[model samples]
Target: MLLKDHVVLITGAGSGLGLGVAQYCKAQGAAVIVTDIATDKIQSLASEFDEQDLLLSCDVTKIADLERCKDAIVQKYARLDAVIGAQGVFDGNLPIQGMSTQHLDQLFDELFNINVKGYLLTAHIFADLLKQSQGALVLTTSTAAYAADGGGAVYTATKGAIRSLIQQLAFEFAPEIRVNGVAPAAIGNSQLKGPKALNLDHQKQSDIPKDAFLNLFQSISLLQELPNAEDYGALYAFLASKQNKVMTGQTLVADQGLLNRAVLTQSH
Candidate 1:
């Protein structure tokens, strides 16, 4: 019951890590507002939610869609206790040299608009509602924010920018609302997709063979096991809970010792 009686709104909750977070929060007694760019995707999970919960179609990059979502949440619940900015796009690790000039601009815009600007807009539009409830904002970052090879230049830059946003927004919203982040490495069964501009919109990380995915992580992580998207749920819950009053402006890394290994190996 970590989130009992809490009302949380999550973006990209149609699949992957966001879906895991939504389910976990609901199981802990929270009323979840799940949103995704694809209406059908959100509708597919309708059976799992009660009437008290909400499922809406939201394109995180659009202010009009966000404003509509905000209005719906306020009308239904009267207040919001937590907001999770989980929408993101990958770069498929496309090397800088490989990208044509035209594709590079589109790729950068696609990734930043969704990954960084989306979170910025979410926080901006919802700041007042969150403040009214003295709530928390939990954002998703990645190990790529701190290390190389997790993504290509564009993806890494966007994640790094998120880390800065977490700190900056936390400072700006302090004493009224708390802000924090979770930085996870690769999830074995994640449905995370790449930008359409890169022709990877249909690509899902989960589509990779299970053994191959596990082997890929096992090669880099000290733990030698791939983490599941569900593994990150509790961390989000903890950060969103009212009981977690002292923590803010920080990102909890859940990379299974990958960063540690990178640091140690580099010291040689």
Candidate 2:
């Protein structure tokens, strides 16, 4: 009941981590608004939500789509308490040396547009609604932003940009709206698609063998247990709720101690 009586919006709720967070938000009693670029993915989520929730097709990079969603939220709930941006793309972890100059340019815009700009646009569009309610805004980053080799160069750069965006946004929106970010590592059941620039859009991270992923995670992670997307919901819920007053302008590293362990192992 952390979000009881609250109205929350979640972007990129089609599948994987975003989908899990949306469900958890609903269970916490928030009138959740779920949106995704994939209409079919959102349609499948309809039954899981009651009338108290809304489902929409949205591309976070598009202002018109977001404006439409805002109108819908106003028509239904009248106010927005929080906005959680979970939309992103992975860069397939291809090394810089492996990529051509042409591929790099294409990937740069593609990943930045979706990974970084999407959050930026959504935050800007929804800022008024959040300020009106004195609510929160939570954007997703990644551990790649903090340490090397967390992802390929382009993907890591995009995530790093988000980390900075959170701080700047919190400063600008202060005394009215709180802004923060979460940087997760090794999320389980992530269907996180790769970049279309690299012709990897048709593939998903989850296509990797479960055992292989788990084994790799265990070797480098101190927790040694891969957390399901829902396991991260409690943190998101709190950050996206009125109960959070002490935290703002920060990105919580929800890496299951992977980075901590990585630093130690690499030091040896």
Query: Which is the leading candidate under TM-score?
Result: 2
List the global CA lDDT of all models: 0.92, 0.92
Writing each residue's lDDT as its tens digit, candidate 1 over 158-240 gives 99999999999999999899999999997868999988998999998888899888887877788876767777899999899
TM-scores for every candidate against the unseen true structure: 0.97, 0.97
Write down the TM-score for model 2: 0.97
lDDT of 1 at 7: 98
Per-residue error at 139 for model 1, in Å? 0.6
The parts of candidate 1 lying over 4 Å away from their true place are 262-268
